[model samples]
Target: MTHEVTDNRQNDSTLASSAFEHQMFKESTATRTSETEMDIRDRLTIKGGHVEGQEQVFTEGAMSLLELLCKQFASQVPQLLSNRVKKQALIDAGELPNFLPQTRAIRDGDWQIRGIPQDLTDRRVEITGPVERKMIINALNANVKVFMADFEDSLAPSWNKVVEGQINLRDAVRGEIEYTSPETGKHYRLNDSPAVLICRVRGLHLLEKHVEFDASSIPASLFDFALYFYNNYRQLLTKGSGPYFYLPKLESHEEARWWAKVFAFVEDRFCLQPGTIKCTCLIETLPAVFEMEEILYELRSNIVALNCGRWDYIFSYIKTLKNHPDRILPDRQAVTMDKSFLSAYSRLLVKTCHKRGALAMGGMAAFIPAKESEMNREVLEKVRRDKELEARNGHDGTWVAHPGLADTAMGIFNEYIGEDHVNQLHITRDVDAPIHARDLLLPCEGERSEAGMRVNIRIALQYIESWINGNGCVPIYGLMEDAATAEISRTSIWQWIKHEQKLSNGALVTNVLFKEMLVEELANVKLEVGAERFTHGSFTQAAVLLEKITTSDELVDFLTLPGYEMLTGQFG
Candidate 1:
C-alpha cells in the first residue's frame, strides 16, 4: 500500500496551536535546535516512504534546505507556468512569438556570459541517461567529456527511483559508487577518469507529489535542485567543479530569470559567490528561441551554454501551433532538424550563444546501435552525418544517448573544433545568414503517411506503458525514446486529428480513424512484445491513456502529466 503523510496529525495541530506544545515534537526532529527543527518540520511534510538510503539523502538538513527552497521560489513557478499559458493563448490567436522588441538592446549590446569552468570548456561529446546506479557508472565511465544525470525526461519519478538517484549521485561524486549484477555477479564501477557530472532537474510545471508544504506539493525543480546541491556542492567544489545543472523545458526569459534567482538564492545560503552555480539551459521550446539573447543575458553570470533540444523543440512547435491550420506538421519521421523551422532555430541558437561567448551545444543523437553489423554501421553513419552538420554549423559539442556513439560524435566535433580550440565561440553567423521570424515558424515540408501515423500510435502506447511502469528511458525501434520523443509522437497525432489531416494514402485523420488505428496498433504492439510480456505490462492502462490524450478535444500539454497521475494513483 502507498503511504502518505496527513496534515491532521494530532501532534501537528497541537504544535501549530502552541509553541510550548511543539517543544516536545521539536526535540524528536533531527538537525539543529528544537525551535528551528519545529519550524522546518511544521511547514514541510515528506509523504514518500523510506527507500534504501533515504535517511542519508533526506536528512533533516536537506529537508530544511528543501523547505527553504519551497518557501522562497515555489510560488514563482505557478506564475511562470501561467505565463506559458498566456503566451500560448496569444500564439493560438495568431500572435506568433517574435524576438522581443524591448530586449533588442540587450541582444544588440556587446556582452558575454561569465567565463566557463575549465572542465566544461571542451564538451565535445556528452552522454546522458537516467540516474540508475549501473547506468550512472557506465555513463560516467563512458568516453565522453560530460554526463548529464537526468532526473527529468529520462527518469521515471517513482519515490524509490528519485531517492536512490540522489544516493547514487552522492556516491558518484565521492568516487564510492558501484554496482554488482545479481545474476552474473559482475561488478561495475567508475573508471579512473570519469566525465564531468551534470544534473538535469524536472521542469517548472512538475510537482513532487510526495512532498507538501502549506498543503500544496512542492515544485519538482526546487525539490531536485535543492537536494542535489545541498548534498554535493561542497564536494563538487573541492573536486574543482561546482553544482553544474541542466535546466529543461523553459519557455521564456522570465523563466530563465526565475532559475537565475534560484541559483542566486542557493549560493547566498551557502555563502558562495554568485557564479559558483553554473548551468546550461535547454532551448527546447518555440518561444525560447525568440528569447535566446534575453535568456543568456538574464543568466549571464551563471550560464555557460545553450543546447538545441531538438525533440522537445519539435513537440513545442506542434504544441505552439496546434490551432494554426496552416502549420499542421507532417509525419514524425518527416519533421527532421533539417526542416526550415528547426534549422532556423538551431542557427539562431548558435548565433545567439556564440555572440554571447557561450557554447552552443547540439541536440541528441538518439539512435541505438543495432545488433546486426550492417545495421549498426548505418546507425553510426547517420549519427556521423548529424554531428557533422552540427559541427560544421558552429555547434561546440553534441549529446549522445549511448556510450557507443560518443567516439563517433567526438571524432566529428574534434574534426570541426581542432585541438587548439576548446569551443566554437569564435564561429559566428551574424554577418552572412540572418534568421528571421518566418524562418523559425515556417511549416515543415513533407507528406503525412498512414504508416507514419501507425508508428506514432505504437511508439506512444509502448512508451507510455513503460513510463507508467516506472521506466522512462526505453529502446523502441532502435532509438532511445524519452519523454520528449514520445511527446512528439503523441502530439503529432493529436494535431493531425485536430486538423483532419490527409495522409499519403488519401485517408482523412479523425477520432474514428485514430481509434481504429489505435486498436490495430495495440495488437501490433502486443505481437511485437510477445504475449507474456504484454500480459504483464501496463499496455491496457497505456492504451486507455494514449486514447485519452491523443483523441481529446484539445491537444494535451504533456502526456506525462496524465501518466504521472497514473503512476501515483493520485488524480486531480
Candidate 2:
C-alpha cells in the first residue's frame, strides 16, 4: 500500500473543473479513473498521487492509452525492481558483473540497430537541459545538433512540470514553442531550423505518483515516454524527423531487454514502423557498464548511440562498490577521465558502439559560463579540454550543459570527424578496450582532503535545497549541478563515512567528525547564499534531508526517492 493524496473529495466533480472546456477530466478521465476493466478489474486501481495544478493534461485519450499500458505492463514493475535486489544480493555474496553468458551469442552475432532518421545521424554536439518552457525553447534554438528535453535528472518531476513539459514538447514538435521571461521580458523561441529533439524519460526505478492502476503507481518512465510519443510522434514524422529518446539509469541487459519490449509495445499500439523510436542508452551504473554491448543488442532495432554519463557513473560506482573496503573512491575531483576505470569505460564505449556501427557519445562538462568574466573564460577553457579528450578518444559527439560550449566541442569533433554529420572514423578498430576487468574496476587511490569532504557536503546540501524547492538544475559555486551530481556528492560522503576514510590532514571520517563538519558547512553555505536566499532556500530542511539519507544504516538506492517523498508529502 502506498500513501495517496486526493483533493476536493467532491462527488461528481471534475479533477480540473473550474471554467475549463467542458471539464475534460470530468467527461473522460473521471469515468475511467475508478472503472473496473476486465483485464485490470481487481488487480489495481488509480487510488492515489493526483497532481493538482495540471490535472487536465490527463485527458480521455492520454489516460485511455495509459490505461491500456497500465493493464498490460504495470504489474511487472515489482518483478523487475525485485530483479535488482536479487542481483545485488548475488553481488553482495561476491559475484561480479561481466558480459552476460546468455547474451554472448547475441554479442558474437553480427547485427546492427535499424537505420535512424537523417537528423539523428550526426549528434556531435547535443545540448541537454530540463523541460522548463524556456529551456525547451532555448535548447532547441541553440546551435547544437540535438536538444534532449530531459524529464529525468535535470527536471524535477513536479506535477506541473511534468504536464507542462508534455505541452511544451508538443509545441516544440509543432514548431510553436516560445517563452517570454516575466522578470527580464526577454523572448525565447526556436530558430528557423532548431536542433533535433530527443526526450529522455525518467529511469525504471521511479514511479509516477499521479497515475496509477492495479494498486501501484504507473512507472514514470512509461508516463513520460507514452505521452510524448502519442502526442508528437506523428508530427515529428511529418517534419522528416521522428521521436528520439535518451534512456537513463539502466542497470542490466535484462532491464534493456524490458525497454526493448516497451518500444515494441508502443510501436505496435501506434501501428508505426518497426523501428520508429530510436534511443541512446546511458551507461552510468556499474552493471550497465558491463552490459553495454548487450543493451545495444537487445534494442538493436532502436538504440542509436551510447553515452558515458560521468556524474551518475561516479554515484553508481561509489554505491555499488561501497561494500568493498579497498575500493573506496578518492575525492570526486581526483577521479579524472585518466583514472583507469573511467578511461577504460570511455574507450570501451567507443569500442563497443563502433564495433556494432553505432555512435559513441561522451560525458558532460558541467561548468557553466553564466556571465562574461575571466573566471568564465577559464571555465570554458576547461570545458574545451574535456571535450577535446573525448574527441581524441574517438567519441562521435559529446554533451554540453550550456549552449556556449557547443561550438568548441563541435569544432574539435569536426576537426577529427570532418564535415560529415556523424563521425565515420572508427579509430579504435585495433584497440580492444578494457581487455581485462581491472581496466574498468581499478581501486582508485589518492590522498583524500578535508577540503574535498567539505565540498561534497556543501554541494549535496545546496543541490537538495533547490531540488526540493522545485529547481533541478542549479548553478552553485560555478557549474550546473543536477540530481546526478548531487547523488555523487552525498553518496561519496556516505561511502567515505562508512569506510572510515582517512583525510590528508590526518583526521578520520567518524560520525562525530562528519556531524561537526556538516554543521560548519551548513553555516558557511548559508553565509555564501546570504540571508534572504538562505531563509527561502530550505537550508534547514536540506541539511536534515541530506543527513537522513546519507547517514542512514543502509545506502539509499536513489536519493530522489526520499527527496521526492519530502516534496510530495506522500510515501508508502
Candidate 3:
C-alpha cells in the first residue's frame, strides 16, 4: 500500500524542462469579464445547512484545487504522500486516538503547556533553610501552599550537600525520617505533616557541558538528573506518587514540550500514569513569555502552578534589553512599585492565567527578615503591602522566606482577602479622627532627649497588654492602629513567656530558647543609639533590667504613670 518516490533527474535543468512543459498545459477558466459572469449567489442550492452554489460550492471547489496542487507537489516531494498514507493507516487501525483526553482540569482558554511560563504576578518568594526535621514540620504547620525543597538557588552546589538535600526531602515526604545537623551533629525526628513538597533541580543551562558554559561535551542533563532522583525516591512520595518538581530557567516552548515527552517516557517505564508527576514551570525568561500560551497548552494540564521569578526575571530583562537603550529597565534596586511596565506585564500574566482558570500566584519575599528590629519590621511592612496588592490583583498565593515572616505574610492575606482598599495603609487610624495640628504633635526639642524612645516603648507596651487580653486591635501611643505591629509584639512576648515557663518547669533551656529570649528583650526596648552602641558594647545595663521588669502589666502601669519620669531618671 506504500510506494516511495524515486528522483531519477540528477540536474535541475532536466527537472525544470519536464515540469515547465506540464505547467503550460494548465487551463485558465476565468477569462469571462466581471460584467458578463453569472453571480454564484443566484445559483445557490440548499443542501443540509450549506448553500450549494454559494459558499459551499466555492469552499468545495477551493478544496479540489488544493488537492490538485498537493498531488502535483507530491510528484516533486514523493515522501509526503507516503507519510500521509502511513499516518492514515495507523489512524484507521485505531493505533492512536484522534485527540487526547484532558486529564488535568483547566479553565477554557488558550495556554502554552510547556516551558518556564511566568506566574500571574511577576513577584515570587522562596523559603530555604537547613533541611532539619523541625524546619520541615514548621513548613507543614504553616499556611504556605508551595513549599520548595530548594536544591538549585538555596543550597550550596557541592555534591555531598546535593545528596543530603535529596535524602532529607525523601524522608520528610515519607513521614518516616530523622535529620542530623551536618555541622552541629544534632538530631531531629520528623512528625506527620501535610505540606506540599516541591523541589527545584539544577539549572539545565548551567550544566557543565552546555555551550554557554564552554564545555567540551554535554554535562549530565538536568532532565536526566531529575529522573534519577524521582526513580530513587519514588517510594517516599505521597502514597507512592512520584516526586513533584519545578523546572527552572526554561527558555522555549519546545524545551517544555521535550520535558513533557521525557516525562511521558519516564512514566511509561515506571508504570505510572501520565499526570502522576506534577510540574510547576518557573517563568523567568523573555522568550518564554511570548510562547507562554503554547507552553501551557502543550502541558495538557499536569501543571500545578506558575511562579513569577523576580531575581531571574530582572537578570533576564537586563540581558535581553542590553542593546536597546530605550527598553532598558532601571537598576534592580530602583525597580519597585513605581515601574509601570512591570505592573502591566504582571497584570497581563494574571489575566491570561485567570482566563484559563489556572492559579496565578504571586512572587516571593526572599529579602525580608525574621527579626523584630526596626529595619526588619519595615521590610516586613513593605513586603506585606506588595503581597496584598498581588492578591487583590488575583494571585492565589505568595511566598515567604523565613518562618518568622510567615505569620506576617498570612496576616496580610487574611486582612486583604475580600476588602477593597486601593492603596494599603501602613499605619491606619480611626477614620472619624479628623486631621489636626494636634495629630502632628512633636516632642519639644531638649524637653526630654529620649522622648521618641519613650513613645516607642509605650506603643510596645500597649501591644503586649492588648495581646494579653486577647484583643486583636490595640491603641498605640494615642495614634496608629497597627494589626501587624501588634501581632509581632504578641508573638515575641509569647515566645519569651513560653521559654521562661518551660525553664521554671525544670526543663533545660537550649540555644534556641536563649536566642529567642535575647531577641524578645531587644524587641521590648527602644534605644536612641544605633548599631555603633552595640558594637562598642556601651549599652546601659539599666535598659536590660528595665526590659525584664516591663514584661508585666503592673510594671507597664507604673512606668506610664504621671510621676514615672522621676522614677526613670532615678533608675538611669
RMSD of each: 9.2, 8.9, 28.6
TM-score to true structure, per model: 0.93, 0.90, 0.49
lDDT of 3 by residue, 1-572 (tens): 22121222223343334333333343244355343122322222211222212231234433232232222221222242244345435633434212122422222333433222222112233344434346666665555544666544443233333334445565566676565788999876643545556666655533212111111222223422442344333443324333567777665555666557656654453444345455767776544554454455555435655666654554444333322323333222344432554454455456545444344556656554634588777777877787777766555567776656777766666565534521222212223233222221111111111222233334444443332222223334322222223222222232233334233244433334434544554544434334554444312333333355434332121112222222223321
Q: Between 2 and 3, whose TM-score is larger?
A: 2
Off by over 4 Å in 3: 1-143, 180-187, 208-242, 370-372, 415-572
Better of 1 and 3 by lDDT: 1
> TM-score of model 3 relative to the true fold?
0.49
User: Compared with the true structure, what per-residue lDDT tens digits does model 2 show for residues 439-487?
Assistant: 6778677768999989999999999988887788988788889999999
Off by over 4 Å in 2: 1-57, 370-372, 570-572
State residue 434's C-alpha deviation in candidate 1, in Å.
Answer: 1.8
Q: Which 10-residue span in candidate 1 carries the lowest summed lDDT?
A: 1-10
RMSD, model 3, all Cα superposed?
A: 28.6
Local lDDT at 100 for model 2: 73
The Cα local distance difference test for each model comes to 0.87, 0.79, 0.43
lDDT of 1 at 214: 91
Runs of candidate 1 with Cα error greater than 4 angstroms are 1-41, 570-572
